[model samples]
Target: MTLQLERDAVLRRHIGPVALAAAVINGVVGAGIFTLPAAMARAAGAWAPLSYLVCAIAMSFVVVCFAEAGSRLPTSGGVYGTVAFAFGPAAGFVCGMLTWMASVLACGGIAGALADTVGTVLPGIAAGPGRALVIIVSIGAIAFVNMRGVREAAWMVTAATLVKLVPLLLFVAVGAVMVLSGSVPPPRPITAPHVFGLATAVLLGVFAFSGMETPLAASGEVANGNRTVPRALFGAMGFVLVLYVAIQLVAQSLLGASLGGQAAPLAAAAARIGPVARMLLVVGAALSMLGWIGSDILGAPRILFAFARDGLLPRVLGRAHRRTHAPDAAIVVHAVIAAGLALSGSFTGLVVASTLNTAGLYFLGCGAAWVLHRRRIQTVGEPVDFRLLPVAAAGGMVAMAVLIYVAPPAEILGLVGVLAASIALYGIMRGIGGRARPPVG
Candidate 1:
């Protein structure tokens, strides 16, 4: 018990429920929300909003399982810790590796989005070394903020979340007023092709919900994590679901058929109000992407830190700064890797690959929840029924499996190669006496 407490003390417990909720909100609401309306409209027509609601309902099951697991472990590495306890070191390693990869790729994708948004406002920023510089600087600044400490980083996330959400809410409010006043035209009836379109939109909607698990990654640093983490997760999910559905409704109401071809549907919707609204929407998009980058940098490195803590990697990577209590080395390593990926100019492909990889990882997490429940693992938070755990786990796994089938073949092949490499690396680490020790409860 002393050893466990000593280990826990290494990470400062400064994140409260509000900050944790902010982290969750920031994680799930990335650059995707700014652009997804057009794609969903193109696929599902007037039914796009329904697709978001359906996907949200499906994702709630997974979130419940994650909450139970996270509350049980209340440690850094989120799913990594849960798998390590329920399965073994090998499964845990693979879970952490896949999650870490997805986060890095996500950061790269967001950085590219930020560059593109900036270039739209100020031309010449997207071409040549200018684009690369913007990506690096953006990522580097977020990393520096995170390196300062969790408290500072959490505040930054909260600020960014508020900044990005205002414009979205404003657009929704305007559209709602128009509808209530009978100024907006009614949406067209769904056609035969729209049924298939709903399926596609649901798939895309599920992908947008991918980052909800991020707050749990830093559980060790959260005050009252056992309770706070779960509350934050559910709260953030509910908030995003309402916001997403509202945005979709607004976009469809205003843009109608024109929404299908719009590259920036929300911004275009805002333009219906005027140029100032359009400019504000663009700024919101930039802030939204920046918030995601900040949140990813804050969450992803905890996996490496957890791995190091368990002896899967060098101990130095797990070391927190003396004054700031931040995982300095791990944060630096994540920044370097993400910056390298951003320069590759494969942001869209990387996003697709990471989406598929994340689905598999979430499935593993559901399995871990089931195993933990069956084993009756002692938890510090509210106890969940063993029967409920299995039901949620099964439902989440099935959802993820469906998502996997929808993934592109090229991304699946890439995932396979990455898994193979992880296996080889695991073997090498084991040979060198680097096998991780089991977590102490």
Candidate 2:
């Protein structure tokens, strides 16, 4: 059934620039950044900061490529929509589902992290059944806020984004002051930078900053989409990238050798800021994870909704909530799947397994850019940011290659399974499509 959802549902313009920025910011500062610096330090030794810089440079390519595609096509499902149009419905469905699963699992990870952070501060509160219950409650509340629709969710994210940013700012500012004044504790200088280790360190750094392209996933929901999508993609990512590097630099300077082993890098840096600020880091880390969860709640369902709308899955899930205008069923599916994985302690394993499919979609997006450019030529219309896209495409190719070689094998395996399921689903869809008649009574 080619279910025709309200044009309002399919072509909604519920987002503005502020909401867009929060979504972008929300995507970037999740649990990865909270813990990655220490591991990166271990990998690169003193050169870890430089490693983060490398990842940032690599990500610029993804942002640029995604921006070009987002502005031109302006659809939900981020890379999935771009790939589908470039290829076919089945390709798009597979791509969308992969991305949806990734975002959902990522959210669960953030929920787990947020709960852990809570324990760090309110030791008793974060333990056992109490902490687990809090995680569920926090996730459920945030998910509900997101389901309330764009305007409401955007406001909450914006506030939460600000809440998360404060501690990061203090980390950088206070670290600098401590070093300049000679108050930073005397420590060993693993300070010397190593190139190869730095590269690996920065790959993890890039993971922290990877949320920028997410705005493209909900392109269909933004007002003045063609213009707004690029603005949000480039503007939000560029700002966040700078802030992330700044945060790391500040953190390293403040904590020195001692900092290299910290689980909560910002919190460690905060200790240098003074005892008062240490408490704030826990608040900020918790907020950052919550922000990530909120963005996941907002973005993932759209991909599933896209899949259902296109007849690749059950059409019942294609329906939008009559009042809220949200994809109610898709939201339920995402929440349930993420929760299942979370309770099973399987989110990390899934990340390992889904890496291949995620990387596959990046190449698929680059291929779409090529196809879109060619189609534009055949029609003889003005080229759609044709000049800038090649750079993004090339960057995506390099990034995907690196991720495939470097990402855990289990992630690649999980991706293979998802792809296989998609192929099977496509065959079933094709059979259904063939037997279908023209739309009639």
Candidate 3:
């Protein structure tokens, strides 16, 4: 029931760098991006992009750390694997809990958002059982797709990523044309930056970029993960950063001072383009949610598999389907958990702590990268690029700490509660290790 446990079944490595990048894009650009322009405008006004830039700067450090760790230790569980490698089983267990909980909670919240999007169109599924049904059907569908095979799941993620990006790019393209011409007034220059508001905006931007880590959870299913991880991280992040900045600039230019007030800022901007464009945004938003859910299902369950493989959870979860080579049991359980959270209405309340959990994982990941470099450890895969590893690791940790420090006290307490529970669960896992350790296949 330890790391030395026999693996009777194994995951297939079908995910290449391109598929991984698509998963990263799908993860980062979800339902939030459609409305994020308005939220950023509210916080930082004309200087919203500056906040994005700051967030990107901070995230780049963290991403580099992940790239390094992923290259050196291309295993399942993403940051959890890295932490366990750098630290120990105890710390690794906590990291796994944090990572899995964050993804599952976010999945529930996004499932709710998807139902809301459906409600906008049908209005019947706006609340109650209708909303619950949407959550179940959506997450259930994604889970099924993931259970089929990694290749099929990767294709779904890639398709969803492309579909979701079209409307946003269209919005940016139309807005850009209007701005370049005389159709829309140019964005007003900000005479002064709002420091506190900008800080808040950066926090929001960080959350928008949070899902990138989730995709790494399936590292074991990735081909040449050492090379794929860094390539996907850099490629997808660059695309997202440019796309986000453009969308924000265009929305600000089109809406001007009125940007922050609109609930659906992208739709509002699209409306100015025409009804067709606006409709596209509506459809795109729903697709975006689906894409994110697909990516979450495709990757997050691997965390459960990783946990079980290490004897921290039921070993049945570590088993892959004989034919499909997919973690079917883990995928189903993760989906069930998310569906329950979505129905219980607690996911919304817990989202702040979910973000905090992600930030904490990133901090630990940065530390792991630092430790790996310090000890010159190469547990698996190819050697990672160590250039700027120390400086990047420090900056990443600081960035995560800033996010953690800025979080509400209640959410901080909630994070602590999760950690404490994880510790207790780890003890229980150890106590019943024999019972939990089932045959892998």
Candidate 4:
């Protein structure tokens, strides 16, 4: 009966490589990019582009590990499934919880950001019930789209990515011409005194490229997932790297020293071009949030579905809607939790905890890639790309270690609490004779 239920709940394979790449793009580029210019400028001034490059190079190591694992274990659980396959169910459960919590926290944080952005245009929606209402409506819309089907969700994500990119690309193109014409000056060169600032900027910039793995959580619904996953990841990463560098350079060129002061640096840069351009960037900021929320809705619930399917969580969450083949219950639950966090304004702590959660994921992801390759495992997709696997895994692990070593004390304590709680819950489930199943071949 249990096995039958699992088989019946399998998701449909509708997400193609291009759609999946769009989803990955949405996941990687979020509300962060809108204000990233100011933050990076504050940390490293005109040398912000260098910080972005450093972070991208470091993140490339991790991306290589993910490319291999995502190709090999093209399943619903994504990072969790890979870690579990390489380690065990208990470890997988812990890693899954970490990834899910980070993603959910990010959703709530982004929701709050969206409400704030809307508030700029419509002051009434900025705070109190107005804010809460906006959060609810936004999340509800995303949840509704996700429930319709993954294909619909993918289409929505692709559209959102286009909407989000247009304004920024315009900003980059116009700003570049301005610099060439001397309407805007070139960015100032970095000095020796800014080395510490450069480090800080790089540290923060590393996370800007995260959320790629979130979309992979729905690998089970991807058509030709093994081939599709790696292609989407690498393609999205390359596009994002180039786009980020260009945006940073343009912002720095136009704003110069004042770039660090604007709350909406891109909008501020656009304002120099004209009022219409500023409005476009502001609107783009809100739409970008919507796109990210949509992508999160599309992918994160698959973690809950996978957990339940494995008997690590309640079985109800594992059930899929018959017609749509979507994990309807898990989708609702994920949105509800995120909305609750947004409305209560308690996601601040979760946001802080998310940094550590991300570090844990990186470590597990790197370890999984190495162990799986060593075992000659290739459950799906093309054969493991062993050429760079060794160097990439080792570098990824070292990078994660630096992240952990530099984390603040509060974040460390929070991570410890999260991990301990996950372990306790897993034990309780096992003690109650949960029908935990082994990994499916």
Candidate 5:
């Protein structure tokens, strides 16, 4: 009984709606927004904003599915818990491993981006040992804070989210003024329809929206997981959709045909505003990347903790710090892997690998929702309609299929390798007495 109580105390429910919303925002709005504009503009030309809108609309379906599943399980593992409840331990283990891999890779990519941003402002730290040190130090700082406690980590994430948004808000305001005053030039006419370009734009836009489910991973730490998770998910999605589309439009209006050529389109757009705006943008981009890393650090370890508790991973990772009530072991392990990747300077490859894993997770998560709905399982939160749940699931499945179809060949090969390895590992574990099953809530 004492052990049970101790275990219960290890993960306290301290996160409220506001902090949850902030985490959701931080997870969804990262450095991708600042960098993807040029690539998107090149892909869809003047129609890039349209692609953002379309992708957001499509992603809403997946968000709904996540909302329903998260509400029902309201556990630390996010999709892993939901999938396990519907499927079995093996399936859940696969989902958890995939989610963990994607998140760690994403954290590494953000660390690299943070290093680049620092390098931009201070050329002295642009490459070599300086860059490596920045990556290591930044990831170490985030991991330390997360090990302190969930509340502390959530508050830090909240502050970072607000700080990161300041420059983006400024850009939107200035862009609005320019548009209203007719100071911004009109977009160039498309000489011909570009189907391939639109497809590429859609893929990039979908990838940008990948972090929507991040906050759900920490639902166990939330005060009102059922209601809060769904509300925060929708709210964050709506907020980011407006912010992304506005930025795309502003970039197009300010740079026009020149938007596609510049390496940093948002920074280029800010240059038109003045040196102060440009400086603020540089700072904002750095903070946004940091916030992404912070959010991932806080959430991803919880999935590991869940996996450990369920016998999929080493039981040591399931333990939390006695005083801080943080998943210390899992956080340290995750940070080590992420730091290694960051130090290797494989940001683009990590991003691609994560994207591929995320596609599989989305499909499995949505399918889990369908299985739960069919079983008529009792859920904790606002009840979803029977008919609507399957529709949401179907939408998510189709979206994931499209994403997987468009994925680069390298990512596909990496994903296959990871799956094969996971299967072998699962078999070896099962050969031992490692299949201690936990009851699905």
Candidate 6:
């Protein structure tokens, strides 16, 4: 009975094409609208837009792997779920744990970023118990909204996604107007860098497209899970790539060398237009942060739910909310973990550490995809209609490995610790349950 329990989840088919597309958009167009421009400007200089193009091109392979593998498996475990179905319980547990830990860390970073910025618009948000209250309240609201159902959750995500994109679109359009008229100054030559520097910058830029696989999470909820997952993956990746490049082109083209030095790169670009544009960009930044917070609160907990259902985590987390049909327990667990990190003063460290951990997990996912692809011939029936998924997955693995090396040392160590800890936790869980014990779902 216990062994059978893990395989007994009901497939609801609540999400449709719109929901999947919106989730893709939500996953891709995150807080980076405000934060990434500055980082890209610093790392790649005048050719930051070029970095956007390169990164987009590189992520194609990763996107394809995720799409194909997710469609074929159609499991709630996501990357780990696919791996677990393909491999075994032990592999699944580690993959699930690492993915969940990465999600929690990333959510904390997004929340921290929002908290600091909330200080700008609402002055009292940064100090005393006031700040903690705001963080807890904000996250709790998102949690309640998500606890409703995936269909409703997807609607919420879609709305937030549109709100985030509006500001970026305005910034790009406004910058173009400034440049077209004689109002903006002309761009000057930005001396190019060595090949290695350029390549390294491009790798991190590609990493910007990191979470594009998120629509895969909707696989369980999606109508025709086998069909919708791949389509949404491609659509989301293309949309974000276009947005990133367009924003970079308008901003860097108009501001040139000046783009790199500003506290708020988009706002600074807007300043070239006039004070109004600057104000709009600031408001947009706030919206972008809010959108990111919303996306994290919605997406991260799903991965944890996947973990818990696989017997890698406490059984309580695997139980769905009977009324809402949502993964309420996993949502609450991750929210608490992330909220604690957000209230602490280590936002920068968490962001760095999370990115590193994410890189490691990504590599594992890619490798698992590769394994599944190579062994496809062994499966019954028409080869399971396997594609060049292994090749695409291998490319993704290589890309993430390169990014890991380029990341800061502290980040590298933090990720190493996360992986090691996840592995140890898995062993402890297995021992407590003992052999022949059925996996929980």
Which structure among the candidates has the greatest TM-score?
Answer: 5
Root-mean-square deviation (CA) per prediction: 3.6, 4.8, 4.4, 4.3, 4.1, 4.5
lDDT of 4 by residue, 1-441 (tens): 011114214679799989888878877887768877777887787778888888888789898899887777677767777787778878888898888887887788778767866776688767899989999999999999899999999898778878887888888998789788987545454333266666557656766788887777777788776688888889999999999999998887777777776656788788887889888988998889888888788878988887787677887999999999999999999999999888775333444456568878888899999987777676544644658798999999898777766666777887788889988878887767565664533
How many residue pairs of model 3 clash at the backbone?
Answer: 0
Return the lDDT, model 5, position 85. Answer: 68
For this target, which candidate reaches the highest lDDT against the unseen true structure? Answer: 3
lDDT by residue (72-105, candidate 3, tens digit) is 7666667776787678777888887888888888
Cα lDDT tens digits for candidate 1, 370-436: 8767766644545444457788899999988887676666777877777787677667767676555
Worst 10 residues of 5 by lDDT: 1-10
Per-prediction tally of clashes: 0, 8, 0, 0, 0, 0
Order of the predicted models by lDDT, top scorer first:
3, 4, 1, 5, 6, 2
Please say which candidate is ahead in lDDT: 2 or 6: 6
Clashes of 4: 0
- Which regions of candidate 6 fall more than 4 Å away from where they truly are? 1-9, 14-18, 119-137, 140-158, 187-204, 261-263, 305-310, 315-333, 343-350, 377-387, 435-441
What TM-score does prediction 2 earn?
0.82
Ranking by TM-score: 5, 1, 4, 3, 2, 6
Error of 5 at 416 (Å): 2.1
The residue ranges of model 4 lying beyond 4 angstroms of the native Cα positions read 1-19, 124-129, 144-155, 184-200, 220-228, 314-329, 343-352, 380-382
Candidate 5 per-residue C-alpha lDDT over 3-37 given as tens digits, one digit per residue, 9 for 90 to 100: 11122245788888777777777777877677778
lDDT of each: 0.78, 0.66, 0.79, 0.79, 0.77, 0.67
Query: Using alpha carbons, what is the TM-score of model 4?
Result: 0.85
